[model samples]
Target: MLKLVVNNDLHVNKKDTITCKNSCDLFDEITGECSINQGVDIDSPYEAARCGFFIHRDSMSVPEIKDHTHFKFSLMDDIDDDLLDDQEIFHQLVGKSIYKEEYTYPLKPDFSSYRDDAKWFVSPCGSYGCWIVNHYKKPLSIPKSKDVAERGWNNRVYKSPIPLHDHQSALPISSKMAWLIDEDGFGQYALLVNGKISSISAPKPINWKRH
Candidate 1:
């Protein structure tokens, strides 16, 4: 019963409904030309994701974080949303050992342990970038809220101290712009510039929490 807050909406472990402009709708595999520039409808996110196009919100722009303290982190469970606006503020209260004593914050979470389900070459065809979804080896029992109507971004920033490509399990798509699908099968997107992954954005969800 793993729950994920993708694109600011809570989603269950099972496949959910989704619709977006897929590469198949725009790019002609045989012709390799832009056939249809508009969005194509799909009933499932996994189905749309397999086609290699995931919505990136309202814009294709990826904002740069000048300061590490300003990093926007994901706060699951019962946490104040205001703290997400300021990383330094979040660290002061939430990052303290007293708050996360029971939690295990590994040095670097294994991003590759998850199984790759699909990949896509992102472009202006969709929400500005492409994405891939990976499922974890096992399901997790994550918590969720009754009201799933919170509309916003819930992305966590994980800056690798060293280059990910240099690692033994270096992802082949390290040089490409793609979303980091979490164990729940939904996560955020990161920008790989000069082989380095920088600021990451939120991913699209099949359902948006409505007020």
Candidate 2:
């Protein structure tokens, strides 16, 4: 499951029992009181990436806004050496699959200015996907398209229940370069571009809502 290590010491288990370092007043400006064992949930993506734990939203409690906190998360299965090299471990932990797609387009025209020239690829997770604009020398920009209605737009829509595809895209740049389009066209996923794993976008709540 997910394990939280704070300051390389205190271990926060059971969300309800998690407490802050000082007192509630310390986090008064924040969303909720910060107390040890106060019971706060972690983001699914962040949890999966850090602890390799797959926690369902239904099983999670409300999250608190904390700052200047140092925590270390580890996955129970990630301790194994064999699984370390495989990205699948992280994918399975996060409940996402690997997505790769490749296509050729005209290079003479300025395709970067037009969104239609972009090529979309579905991620293994099926929750999110990404698009690549070969002419731009960068990935495509599309909104998240998880919803069927939203998918109607030019954004790449991820098919629910996951799909089987042999499409693979080339980076022409780095070996780790891979673009993933989520079911929603609102976001894109890539590996270590300019020392960053993925691009940042407005955080989407566990469910659809305007925060």
The top-ranked prediction according to lDDT is: 1
For every candidate in turn, the CA RMSD to the true structure comes to: 20.3, 17.4
Error of 2 at 76 (Å): 6.1
What is the Å distance of residue 178 in model 2 from its true position?
A: 3.8
Task: List the candidate 2 regions with Cα displacement exceeding 4 Å.
Answer: 1-78, 83-174, 192-202, 205-211
Q: 100-143 in candidate 1: lDDT tens per residue?
A: 22321122221222224444433322223233433334543322
Whole-model alpha-carbon lDDT for candidate 1? 0.33
**Estimated TM-score for each candidate:** 0.21, 0.19
Residues 55-168 of candidate 2: C-alpha lDDT, one tens digit per residue: 232321112222211211122332455644656444332322233354232222111212343454445554333444232233344324445423322233232222122222
Local distance difference test values of all predictions, in order: 0.33, 0.30
